[model samples]
Target: MTLTDVLDDWPLWGISKQPISANQISILEGGLTNRCYQLSLESGEYIIRISAANTAELGIDRNVEKTIHQLVSSLNFTSAIRYCDDENRYLIRDYIEGEVLSDNVEDMSHNTLSYMVEQLKALHQVPVEIDLPVVNISEKAEAYWQMLATQQPNNEILKMKPLMQVAMSEPPAGDFCLCHLDPVLANWLYTAEGLQLLDWEYAGLAHPLWDLAALFQGIKHSFQQLEKKSKKNSHSEIEQNLENKILTLYGVSDLVAWRRACMQMEYLSSLWYQAQAKKDSY
Candidate 1:
């Protein structure tokens, strides 16, 4: 179906009368697997997210997202789901009125960071009854490497396989928790109420540090800022500042476990870049 057809059929949106005012439909950029539009309506604005090509290949499930949005909306850590398709694919959510933390980090004060951390902690605190897919870091790293292997071999890319071997050799000690597997800066909204996290396509039950590591990996900060901002209660100074903050927020005591999780995420992300490069080259 066409994008408009999909929108009109959305059960949650209740869109009728052919979208009378559509001039304000602006594309919100910056994601490889989804094209999001800020769709302004006569009643209110809604965020319409359409999964891009091969989303299934990347392990996305819209049903899972619907379940998660329902679960977390109960905890008040995220925006409520307005509508979704039968496949848990296309979703329309209440347009969270705030700036993405990435768009205005300088505007975010210390209070903002505390609020963001609390929201993450709330997500981690959710009970584990839901049988979400486990995002096994080591296995994901392997898939990433296999994707990379299809590309022009770089020494750094080749090193990932060895890294995966080492990472998988030992198991982390803690049981997995509810994790927002992709906690990049853009996914978080800093509003007056605090930080409201968005997008659950990558949500899963996984190691807690994985989210923090992913967030820290994407934040554009220098080493000096990293040192000054690192939390004192974190397991080690080696963990990135954001990861350290997350660990501190969650009261994590095992520094080694966090390190291993971060390593796995780093390997997985590198592999993704390599795979994308190979695809572009062809």
Candidate 2:
């Protein structure tokens, strides 16, 4: 269906208007859960994102997303929501013109990791009350394991059960902040000024270190090349550099607490991927 047809029934516009004519470019083809389109317009491009595979069935709350977007926008950490159809879960956003950090971080020179950490720090600094319903780490893991039980008998879920146990046993020992729970490379755009975050579907109130750990896990393999290309730096040294940058930017004085948070996030990563895999199959 055309964008106009899909959004034709939206009540927010009240009066129906013709959809803006633009060349529709499909930028993200690999995302399993959402159908995202980049609409190139005469004035500027815009993004049109729609949930896939019945996100509502998988615990996605469009109303909660709307609230989170407003909260995050107030702090300037994410793009402002231009228009939303809460019932249909269609979103229109002003497209950001910048390179995705995946491409920009290829070489990783001159404190690029540090810059990202600082950017994340600025995002976490935004304090706001999150009334949104967010899936906790244990719930996320349980969903994955449940899917595994129904799909294939994979021992990986059994192996991860204990890890999840350890992670959820200890509650967050530090202050909670507004966190961008998902840190995919596509979610970040690097501009001349700084990094801009996109995609608020997974945002909520959580420990700040969650985002940091998620980013590290996502980019671990990709950043290896950056580590090799760096002058006089070992892989461990590069990893440490990234960690220090995150700590410094977030002003984290409790290293032990932060480390525990990162560990928890790593296990959550396993569950997230597992969940995505199940969603793709069925």
Candidate 3:
């Protein structure tokens, strides 16, 4: 539950038989649902992630995550999970030394782009051998809204309520697959083991397009932020070409539905951030 607790209980973590000093642990940037620490053990380095409280209330199912993660790990699409807690309190994985795909996402070589898309394609095809839960877009949005409502939401948050409703009104994508649901650029890494998606809390059975929508939107956001910082005009055409290539490569012909899913993904992302901001207890 706390850094002190983790350090004090090191032997129980399935890391090493030997004890480790406090100086061996250092904080690392983490995702929305957990606090991360990199432990430099004598054998090697590892990442110990302490999950946030009330994960179930935030639409995260640790059991489902574990099952799906094991499947992905087998395919070499994610970091090797060295030790997973029985109570879902913490996870220890080998520390991956590599770069995220965020900066080069907008201008990756053609072969690199294809390889990335191929990885995503392969993930979507993973068999639903285990009984995994399907994602409920509407319910998830409402759950986030309820949490946010208690926080004295501001004007921006208030306005998102309606926009979220609008996004929810659209029909769901026709197909389902084992989707990562959060394939944003930062989650992707090019480690020696190869490309891997680090975060697994949001993974579940969802539309194939949900991952795509998240991916493209992530690229657009990264480029826009960079453009603003550099004081350059935003290049909408680059975004268009990227989308076109993905559409053609992934065989997604329904532009209307794809665009709709992208919009809904944006609103859903906004709601999750506001809700998490108010409730995150690390």
Candidate 4:
């Protein structure tokens, strides 16, 4: 709904105690699967994320997002959610103020990477009670493949689909913990208190390396995106030595295995983009 549409309903939507005359809201850009609006009122700043059409088909479980957000908030990793719609159409949360990390994605410093590794280590230690679904490359690739069954998938993507099965069958380096599968740079915010990761839509149980791998791949993707924006013809791959340092900081022993895990994440990321593109076409 447009801001005007939302304002027409006013307090009827239960946004705040203030009436429509007192309410102030503006759209926040960079939403991939939902529409986000920054709402300022007499109370405080909040973010209201309006769900997109057919979001469920993207394999996002709003219930899991609520559970993970609750835990992460207690750990001070993100702002607390103020409200979540009963039918999963929307959610309201504290609009955190900080430097959105996407602005620095292409030239992220070593210190930032180190800090992120430390936080990820703490996150991996969080206990998981429920049987959360695994967001492994094999499972997600297949699911996304089925979602795009009618559409013509890219030739490269078709070839990469079978490779995920091998990674899925291999024994993981460690047990599963809560993994944030989508650490895309846009969801990151560097705050004075600490690093704040927003958007827990893809949180699930998975190998710890999955998050690390996803981070590595996500960073590289940001660089590519920057190059594309400038219409550049060539771009170098993210330095393997830097990836090595990230693994070393994370205490990864099996370099070969980690590379394989990174490949799995790379494939899954592509499939996810393809699926989202297909969804948007509708």
Candidate 5:
């Protein structure tokens, strides 16, 4: 179905609707599992997100996502959901006017870092009334591996299975709290109001450290991209400096956090690639 067809039946939540023209709708990038677009109207700008098919295979529960959006919007940490359609798997939200953060650590100022840490701490403290799924990295990875094997056996995935097992054997110690499983830089926006986190589809109850680890992995991935483009070893140094800064900000020792981050990074990357392969096969 076309976007217009979807919007024709959208519950606008009392907002006045204008003639939505092609010029007024622009596709937004960065989402891997959803189609995002910015819709401009005489009333205001908004974001319409359409979930991709078969996302359930990746452990995304749209019902859980709706609950998360409501909770975070109430806390003013995310954009307010103007309307949601559970059956259609689409939602309209107030468009946040701000700069979407870059993954580069150098681009992140000390103030931004502090703000990020504060927001994350607050997110972890929110009271969750509904029972959210726990993110078990090892089990998730193994599940993905098995799924991928059915399509076409991957030797690399098989080899990584043993390592994933070893990594999970000595799991990090931390309280299970609400976490944004995918906090990569693109999901963060710095606005006049404050720092707002977008895309809560992957949000769930897990080790608070997992959030930190996801952030670290995101920064490291950004540096890796830079290293590939510039062929400079300086990117590695910058990544290490950022890691040290993160460790200091969180008051965690380098040993425990880094190890946990590495393990989570591996599991996340493996699952991500397998998911991509699965999607492509479909």
Candidate 6:
């Protein structure tokens, strides 16, 4: 269905028959499994997210997402939700005015990293009253691998099995807390108010270190990309500094254990994207 059709049936924050002009709506980029659009009106700017098909197969529950959004909004960590349709899987929230951080970790300043760490600490402290599931990286990776095998049936993909098995052998040592499983650079917005996190599709109770590991993995990946393009190991200093700060903030002194956890999480992330790609192709 078109945006117009969806909006027409939208409860619209209690405004009946709200007229939305075509020019007022602009599509937003980078939503891998959903359609995001920025809707401008005299009322204010808002974001409307339409869920993708078969997202349930990936373990995303719209109801849980809505609950998590509401809880996070109450903590002032996320944008305000104006309306949500559980049945249709459409969500409307106030648009955040800020710059989405670049995927390159070298672009992140010390101040930005500090702010992100602070926000993460606060998020991890949030009490878990909601029935959020604890994220099991090994299980998720295995499930994705199975799905991909059915879809593509390739050797390269099968190669991940042994690696995943090894990663699962040694579990990360950390307490379970509310964690944003996917905190990629795009999901963070830097604003005048502070750093705001967006997208909670994978939010749940998981190892507190999982989020920190994800951040480190992002920086490492960005550094590798830079090296590939420049034929030099650039951005190593910045990446190391950021990693040190994150480790200090999270109180993780065991570098080897930390790196192992990050590697496991990164592997799970790889499997997830591969599965998503296969699903999209079908």
Q: Between 1 and 2, whose TM-score is larger? A: 2
Error of 4 at 212 (Å): 0.6
Screening candidate 1 with a backbone cut-off below 3 angstroms (N, C-alpha, C), the clashing residue pairs are: 62-88, 63-88
Q: Once superposed on the true structure, which residue ranges of model 3 sit more than 4 Å away at CA? A: 103-107, 153-163, 166-173
**Comparing candidate 2 with candidate 3, which one achieves the higher lDDT?**
3
lDDT values for all models: 0.68, 0.66, 0.79, 0.76, 0.76, 0.78
**Pairing residues by index, what is the TM-score of model 6?**
0.89
Give the winner by TM-score: 5 or 6: 6
Which TM-score value belongs to model 4? 0.86
Question: Candidate 4 overall Cα lDDT vs. reference?
Answer: 0.76
- Residue-by-residue lDDT tens digits, candidate 3, 81-170: 888767888888888888888857656666666777788899998888888877878877887887787775553667667666765865
lDDT of 5 by residue, 1-282 (tens): 358766676445455455467887899987777888998877789998887765665666788888888888999989898888758578889999998887445577767877787788789999888877877776656656665766667546566667667767555776688888778888899889888999998788887777877887886787787778888777666677777777678777647756775677667766767756657421
lDDT of 2 by residue, 77-154 (tens): 667676776465577777777887767555665466667777777777875654645446676556556665656576
Say which candidate scores most in TM-score. Answer: 3
Candidate 6: tens digits of C-alpha lDDT, residues 195-252: 8999998888887677888877766676778789898876777666777788887678
Give the residue spans of candidate 1 off by over 4 A.
8-12, 149-166, 169-171, 220-247, 278-282
Candidate number that wins on TM-score, 3 or 4: 3
Root-mean-square deviation per candidate: 5.2, 4.0, 2.3, 3.2, 2.6, 2.5
Task: Write down the worst ten-residue block by lDDT for model 4.
Answer: 1-10
Clash pairs, model 6 backbone: none
Would you give me the overall lDDT of model 3?
Answer: 0.79
Model 6, stretches more than 4 Å misplaced?
Answer: 1-4, 15-17, 103-106, 159-170, 226-232
TM-score for each predicted model, relative to the true structure: 0.79, 0.80, 0.90, 0.86, 0.88, 0.89
